[model samples]
Target: MTQLKAGDPAPNFSAKDEQGNTISLGDYKGKKLVVFFYPKASTPGCTVEACNLNDNFERFQSLGYEILGVSADSAKRQSNFKTKYGFQYPLLADEDKAVIEAFGVWGPKKFMGKEYDGIHRTTFVIDEKGVIENVITKVKTKDHTAQILAD
Candidate 1:
C-alpha cells in the first residue's frame, strides 16, 4: 500500500454516497475531513469503528471535522449499514474503487491464513487546506475517535 502521510495532498475523488447522492472531495473544501475506509460494510471490525465515530460525532464536528466512510459496497448495503447504526455521516459507496485506489488503500491482506486483495482499514485526516494531517493505519476500532482526536 502506498500509504498517504502528513503534508501530502489528499487525492481528490467523486463518488456516490449511500443515499445515491453524489459526493466529492471538493464539497469539503476549506473544512477538516475524516475519510475512513473499511474492508466491508457492517462487518464486525467495521461496525465498531463506525459506531465509535458516530457516538463521538459531535466531538468531531465541534472540532470542525466532517466524517465520511468509504467501502467497495453497493449503495443499498451502505445505506443499510448507516441506517442500522444510525450513523449521522455519509458512507461513500465506492463500488468502482476509484476513491479507494486514489487513496492507495487497496492491496493484499491476509486473514485467517487466507490472502486476498481487499481494502485495508484506514483513515485519513485532511486539513482545511486539502492536505493530509494524519493517516491511521494501526486503527483501534473500539477507540477510533480517540485516535483521530489524539493530534
Candidate 2:
C-alpha cells in the first residue's frame, strides 16, 4: 500500500467498537477526525497515550474534532482498556488489520533489536471532507494530546 500523506483521501471503513457498535468513517462526515493507530491496547505507552487523549477529549470536541483509536486488539481487550482508562471516545477493534493496512500503519516494527510485523504508532488528522490534513508519524505517547493540539 502507498504511504498515506496529507491531502490523500482517508479510506472509509466500518469497524466494530468496543461495545460492538458499528463505527464508520462516513458516519463522521462534515466533521474533523483524529484517527490514531497504536500498537496495542492497555500497554504502557498505549495507556498513557489513551489517557492523555481522554484528558483532552473535551478540548478536541470543542474544536469540532472527534477522536478514534484503532488497534489489532480484540473487542474485549479494547473494552477493558477503555473502561480502565475512562476513555470517553470510541476505541475500534481492528483484529483483521484491514483499516490498519489501508492507512499504512500496519508494518514491520523493531524494538530492542527484534523486528516483527505490527501496528506502527501513528495518527492522522482528517478534515471534514475526508482528506487527510496532517500525518503525525512520530508520536510521543506521554504528551500526545498537547502535541496534536499544538499542531
Candidate 3:
C-alpha cells in the first residue's frame, strides 16, 4: 500500500455515514479534520481508539478538529457500533472500500501467522486546506487522543 505522509494532499472521499448521511471531505472544507481508518467496526481495538477520541471530543473540537471514523463495514453495523459506544462523531461506512482505497490503507496484513488483506489502522490529520498535517501510522489505541493532541 502507498503510505500517505505529512504535507501530502489528503485524498478526497464521499461516503455514507452510520446514519446514512452522505459525508464528504468537502464538507470539512476550510476546517481541520481527523480521518481514521480501522479494520472493523465494534472490534476491541477499534472501540478503544474511537472511545478515546469521543472522551476527548470536546478538546479536539476546541482545537478546531472534527473526527471521522471509517471502516469497510455495513451502514447498519456502523450505526450499531456508534450507538453502543455513544460516539459523538460520524462513522463512515465505506462498504465499497472507496474511501479506504483512496487513503491507501488497505493491503496485506498478518494476524497470528495468518495472512490476508485488511485495513491498516491509520489516522490522518488534515489541515484546513486539505493538506495532511500528520499521519499516525503507529497508533496507540488507548492513547490516540493524546497522540493527536501532542502533534
- What is candidate 3's TM-score against the reference? 0.98
The lowest-lDDT stretch of 10 consecutive residues in candidate 2 is 1-10
Model 3 misplaced regions, further than 4 Å: none
Off by over 4 Å in 2: none
For candidate 1, write residues 20-135 as lDDT tens digits.
Answer: 99999899998999999999998999999999999999999999999999999999999999999999999999999999999999999999999999999999999999999999
Ranking by lDDT: 1, 3, 2
Q: Between the candidate structures 1 and 2, which one is better when assessed by lDDT?
A: 1
Of 1 and 2, which scores higher on TM-score?
1
Candidate models: Cα lDDT each: 0.95, 0.91, 0.94
Cα-based lDDT at residue 93, candidate 1:
97
Enumerate clash totals for all models, in the order shown: 0, 0, 0
Q: Write the per-residue lDDT of candidate 3 for residues 25-73, one digit (tens) a residue.
A: 9999989999999999988999999999999999999999999999999
TM-score of 2: 0.96
